[model samples]
Target: MTQDPSRADMEAVAEQVFVALADPSRRSILAALASGGPATATDLANRLPITRQAIAKHLTLLTDAGLVTPEHGERRRVRFRLHSAPMQVAQQFLAAMARDWDSRLDALKDHLER
Candidate 1:
């Protein structure tokens, strides 16, 4: 049987994922990465108006947050790909929050009608 991840592990990963997405540049990077499998810093920079250096900086943040993984190619050229695990965690958190809000709203409506 598969082992479930602990709550603390999920929370930590979710936090990192959220923090990475909180930045506009990083979000844009993720979007670009999602559209195309993996891209190098220069490739991403060419797609965006940003400089290669700026893309590198954003990539570092994304790597740290576990949103992206860099693969070492010949000459150590880094290619980034999306890490879906953290994204899933973030989605689950949002879904839970929405469900909680819905329950609270239903309770409020019931109280008002009574």
Candidate 2:
């Protein structure tokens, strides 16, 4: 089936971010990458309790969601690094929603005061 471009917009990115972050292990993997910089799947596996295969699966999902990027270094070493774009998009969305709620609350407060 043909994909819908509109369905894959910023909102979709936000959705992907939420889905990717929903898993605790994935969150830990992301944190590891964020704090330690780029790391190979084996490195992450060693750091976390998760096995290499499990880490690889999470990395694949993260990569697909644009949360992480993979780079090939010398000796064919591939390491994954976090990408901020998707997270930033998700943060912007949450901020906008918070602002909307604040505006509505202020309006309600003013109406009650008047």
Among the numbered candidates, top lDDT falls to 2
User: Model 1, which residues run further than 4 Å from truth?
Assistant: 1-11
lDDT of 2 by residue, 1-114 (tens): 655564347568899999999999999999999899999999999999999999999999999999999999999989999999999988877886689799999999999999
Off by over 4 Å in 2: 1-8
Q: Rate the local accuracy (lDDT) of all candidates.
A: 0.87, 0.92
Residue-level lDDT for 92 in candidate 2: 75
Structural similarity to truth (TM-score) of each candidate: 0.81, 0.82
Please, what's the RMSD in Å of model 2?
4.4
Count clashing residue pairs in model 1.
0
In model 2, the clashing pairs are none
RMSD of 1: 4.5
CA RMSD, predictions in order: 4.5, 4.4
